[model samples]
Target: MDWDDMRVFLALARVASLGRAGQVLKMDPATVGRRVSRLEGHLGRRLFHRSHQGYALTEDGLRLLPHVEAAQAHLSAAETPNDTGAGLSGQIRLGAPDGCANYLLPQVIARICADHPALEVQIVALPRLFNLSRREADMAISVSAPQAGRLHVQKITDYHLHFAAAASYLDRHPPIRQIADLRGHSLIGYIPDMIFDKELDYLANLDLHAARMTSNSVPVQLNLLRQGTGLGVVHDFALPHAQDLRRVLVPVFSLTRAFHLVRHADDLRNARLRRFAEALIVGLRDQVARLEQAVAQADDQANSENP
Candidate 1:
């Protein structure tokens, strides 16, 4: 009913234990239990299921979590005074697919952190859609803008991808002059069923299969391609990281995909998130352009030398 009661609820929901929640809130275990019971009684709906294991959120608790978290965000923003000569003095987390996380996020984060010395950032790189409602991260970088959710979506930038393979693999295997020539060879790529976004199904879009070597991580697939084992589609920004992997069938197989900045709609009023999102959007567009230029220059050099 109040911020104090919601605070107790949130602490217990996170740790799922009375003693642990007490430790977090600096309250006695008995008091914590009492607060939870009192809150539940006020609502006339159970928020948690208590057992020997721990306190698990009931259906109602899950539904209540986002609202409480939103309130907490507002309070957190208010507590940290802005214009204190300390730029962005709080931690913000970002969830992103592994490809961009590995290849692009480091430099961009470096710039943002350099500008905001008091800021802290946690990067959660996984091969899945982050649950913004649950506060999985303050924001997420998605390959495709989600059609469903109470969120703000921004198209950060467009990046490129192309079919590539290690030099040794190409030398040993038959040449792929055309898409039809990709027979009897499997491309290294994300696990088909594990691809979190349709934009990442590069091979599937090409009517090609990737069963020989696969992983949920883009870095792992990139490494597999670097090993001269098989061919695969790779991001242009990532090509610079592994020199041995060379682009092939570039004229025949290339793709352009966009990265989207996604955040909860409730946080739009929060100044900290708004500032960070702007910096992120600007930095990503610049980085993608800079990296794609490098890829193009490298391709030009390769052609001039060979021809």
Candidate 2:
């Protein structure tokens, strides 16, 4: 039994898709498929049931899983000492929401890379959850903490969001005096149906009938807000770049969401992964004050009245 073949098998089993497993392995889908087939031939047993959706483990595959996992753990343990001395030299796939990836993580990741040049960090920015159990990401920055999983979870930071719009739009439109006044104006937000996480369902808490413009991407929503399209929930960290935008209903309409750091239990034991996790925590902690700052200036007229 080839260890490399087992590694491919584990990646496929965890990700359940050839493309994604290939991504983890830095191989093409065709290569991953071939490798899996080769491994099955070597084993003389069918390991996976292939479908359009993804590959699922056969009964035999399930039976083989624990033994393979134990072997993997032993191999990882044996390599840890060499890795610690060699410096951080492996890839880490980090999954995060667009808001964090675009606005916050790049700087942190860049710094980490600069300090440890051999390390490679792949950022997967999407609206949906990353399954740590499946190794979708080595580490994930999630909106909410995981309730159940063989994972290590920690609160990274509490970031704030506010109702914001381009100054030009607010100036041209009727004043938003109260929550009810929102109905009379055009609003921008996430498409309700496209919201993957319950924590991302910002519109549900508001007195909103429909959004004037909707997008799954936070950057898109912010762009529309900057274009003077309509008011929408904007993260404070993103406010610094869009000079024309201003937060409306600050303090009152502001929302706080916690970013949690999550990693699979097995990966947590890896020296490289532990170091990356520490770097992420330190990076996020450094941004605490900036992320928590009020989006609007104190003297702004929008801050004076309740709307």
Candidate 3:
């Protein structure tokens, strides 16, 4: 099968729509469709079932995907490395969730800009998921665990989150001495699935049926919290660097979500990509201690207020 065809198929599989796949590839939707059809014809089997929601993989497509992915990885690794500057000098496309960008990336971005002035870096804020295989982005910062794939991936940090409320709201509402007490209060939340499973997964431990408001934008949700709409589960990194909010007395279980730095296996060999990745890793490590300190201070203040 044509390697380009396989790539298109993989993009379609990941995106679940010809339009979205085309957007990532910078190709016309018809061209993406033609390429997928050609691949199916070459294989002499129906690979996808077209549906209103999007294409669903047929049994044949599911069976062929693993082999296709392996072949692509093997072929990609065989290329001779190019002479990229021992340092970096080209644009590195980075994608990140807004919450992560707001809380975690400012220092990293500043250092990268200072160190590699020639490198034109572009950061795309992706509140929704981005497709890496389609080259939609060169690197991604996400809270989710990396999936099984041919990716150069590493966990940069484990971020913690806990439920918190405005001091005024806590005073007006009934006391929350236990997780069960949260049921009576209005709740604010991130767009349910966009939040990494681990971060909110234990909400199952809480008895609330649903959030009063759900937003992908942390700033918007935080604003609502300031209005005393409800308590919210917010990342330690994203919480305000002030004492306006207080942690309720519920058992604060630490929810650890992995912050992953990922690049396509092929992109990993590009010297610029490698250098930026290293810089990001180093820059983030340096600030992690400071962030933990800030969180500890917040906890201390919160304890004082609640008691």
* TM-score for each candidate, following the candidate numbering: 0.83, 0.82, 0.68
Candidate 1's residue-wise lDDT over 1-307, tens digit each? Answer: 6779999998887667899779768899999999999999999999999999999888999899878878977886786647243577566789999899999999999999999998888888988998876556779999999999898898999999988889899889877889888877867878888877888887765665546888999999999998888888899999989988888888887899999999988888677888889899999999989988998899899989988
Q: After superposition, how far is residue 249 of candidate 2 from its true place, in Å?
A: 0.8
lDDT string, candidate 2, 1-307, tens digits: 8898899998888778999889879999999999989999988999999998889888998777656766876777777765555557767789999999998898888988898898888999998789765556778999988889777888988888888889899899777757776786778888888898898888787756888799999999999988888888888888876778877776467688989998877665566677778888899767655555534353254447744
Q: Name the better of 1 and 2 by lDDT.
A: 1
Clashes of each: 0, 0, 0
Please list the C-alpha lDDT of all candidates, in the order they appear.
0.86, 0.81, 0.73
Superior candidate under TM-score, 1 versus 2: 1
**What C-alpha lDDT does candidate 1 achieve relative to the native structure?**
0.86
* Per-residue lDDT of model 3, residues 1-307, tens digit only: 6889998997787567999789767789899999999999998999889999988778898777656656755554453255434545645578887777777777778788887777767788767556665445778877665686667778887766777778789779777777777777888886667764454444656667788788878778777887777888777666655357766653545566667887767665445566678888888766665776787787787679867
Off by over 4 Å in 3: 1-87, 193-202, 241-243, 301-307
lDDT, candidate 3, equals: 0.73
Better of 1 and 3 by lDDT: 1
Task: Answer with 2 or 3, whichever has the higher TM-score.
Answer: 2
Candidate 2 structure lDDT: 0.81
- TM-score for model 1? 0.83
Off by over 4 Å in 2: 11-35, 48-70, 81-86, 174-177, 291-307
